[model samples]
Target: MCCLRRKKNKQGQYQELISVVPSVPGHSAPVIPVSQGFCARHGEIPFSLPPRCVPQNTAVLRDAERQEKEKEGAMKVDAQRDILAHRGSLSVGSWYPVGSVLTGLYSMTPLSEVVAPPLGMATRLCFSVEYRHSSEQLVVSLLRLSNLLPRFHSNMTLVELRLLPDDRRPRQAKARGTGPDPEFNDCLIFQVSAVCVLRSTLSVCVLSVEKDGKRHAVGRVLFPLEGELGQAGRVLWRDLDPEEETQCSELGDVQISLSYSSSLQRLSLVVLGARGLQLLTDAGVCVQVSLQIHTQMVKTKRSCVVEGEQDPIFNYRMTFKLRPQHLDDACLRFELQHPNDNRSEPPALLGVLVLGPFMYARGLQLQHWMDMINKAQEPVRMWHRLGRAI
Candidate 1:
């Protein structure tokens, strides 16, 4: 019998060959007849091989089939490259099958079609100012405030006027109506010099009073008293800028009248009233006044307690003995306190105010001090804003 085996040729290629061997030892094997058929792709077969060797032509056929597959694969790759090259220019409709409905369509709405929440109303104040050259006094007449938005069910609104850089003493008018529009035919007069009329600005603040006596600054306007506006008296309407939440959280105002008598070597402070104070508890509130000289507590006094009144009227007076030489280092501290039921426990502090020289105070506090020193023996009354406790 004979078997077919594969061997490598000198050209490094594998070829199929038939190996002849005897079935019995030392005996010649019988030879079979070779096939005379010829392959259509690989040509004719050798005549020396047996008929069983005819299957060897399958290896050649596999090689020819593999070549044809490689050619077809190369053609397919080139076609895909051409499609990808022009992909950007192709329309979306061409990518999908014809008559197929497109799903999940996305569209954006125009800005004009979008609805937003309506804003609050704009507040306007109508007023006029006239500076008299002969009297050196600037007179401001507040006619009315229109379009005032009510924060609470019952709103009481007031107007505060201040002359900047020259005078910081706040002149407040009585609060008016609970409606959106309130009329205030109030007039405020401030003594000014020629330079003050040209350089100073008039600040008008509109405040809303709540039932709890908490005051919120709704809006404010700063009008420059320069050029034609300060020279000629004309009625003008100005829009008020809305106050921020930080400004509204300020601890109210305290009306204090100060007078320093050099002859008596004494300083008298009258706490007439306080408005817009914030009360956190049902306990009564009192004002604790302390006199500090060179950071040392010299004397301390407390006002009478008022129950259930956030805007309390104390009308209390306290006197401090002070020398003229120590006036520069003297400071007065005021604290709003809630008295505790137990006398042993300390009172709860709400707000504080300090009035001293330029090094210790600024704004209205410093201005108050300078005014007291400038107009000695004369009572200088002003409304001072309170701040949070230390």
Candidate 2:
């Protein structure tokens, strides 16, 4: 059964967390019968514990009594096998499916010739902005909005102005939010340094802000400031588009331990168990965990599959030598497949989890990760969520 815990957030809002526990002894809990198989689309099953088997006695007994005992033993074994089959069906077709910390303004692009306006340069550019129609995918659209909010669609949006070369922090200017094809008669201004007028370029970014105050850039345009900011200021019109959507799915989770060696510059990962798998196979599944470092070239390490078990206990340890400087470019990817040699069919991908050290270091699990890094020699065990390939 699942346990629910509740707590109040800083804003006095209540939130819930769920955890599961084993069945209680001697209690008759509601259970889904093994006869009824699992549903592929909806993985719902009544929770129940399988019955224990009775052992046979060595002492002599009446023929009728012995025969009856043997029959009961067979029945117990069959019941256990039925439960395993049900669990396999559930594993083959179950899915309990269901932010950003910004560091300093860094390089958005990698062209060396580009330079940002010097700090403390005082200059202001005024803009009359509007958001026209956007054909971008819904998911990507939420990411590229002028408002800093995440939503199905945004009505309130604004533009943030930045002077390129990226050494200086960029400032934001907001536009009034409107519905689709929203028009903003409101004017916004950005004050930048004088150097921004010389060799630096102007980057106008469209942002979308939610009621909760989260925002992201929808699209941006780069304008060369060579001589555009002369005596008379100029008004320009621009349009932006969000990038394509990256594919993601709620597959399951894998429990693993991580440790790093500062002196040897090596990282060791211990695969523990992958739970909540939803692979469709009669012979069970295998998991493949790999790590890749992308510096100038890509380096990779792959682990052998944990055969015969859907939710396998690998206890496999893999290590890689990685420099602290190259940590940002590293990625860990996990996959689940059927252990087959038929060669005729490719392995099915049950689910996957891909993590980039740099980006994920700031997540809620940051403390656990930091501890692993700081203690270098100590390994921290954690459960990481799995997702579909992009």
Identify the candidate with maximal TM-score.
1
lDDT of each: 0.74, 0.52
Tens-digit lDDT track for model 2 on 1-390? 345577888998876575354444565754543433533333563465689755485353467688999999999878766665554433322232111223444535521122222233222122422222242110001112222223425545766454444323334444444543333334333343454336555565555567786544455565665655443322443344342221222665677778888789888888777766666666666667666665333444445666554467778788877788766566666676766678688777777765454454333134334546555677766566676666
All candidates: TM-score: 0.41, 0.34
Q: How well does model 2 score by local distance difference test?
A: 0.52
Q: Which ranges of candidate 2 are over 4 A from the true structure?
A: 1-250, 295-297, 360-369
Tell me the spans in candidate 1 whose CA falls farther than 4 Å from its real position: 1-249
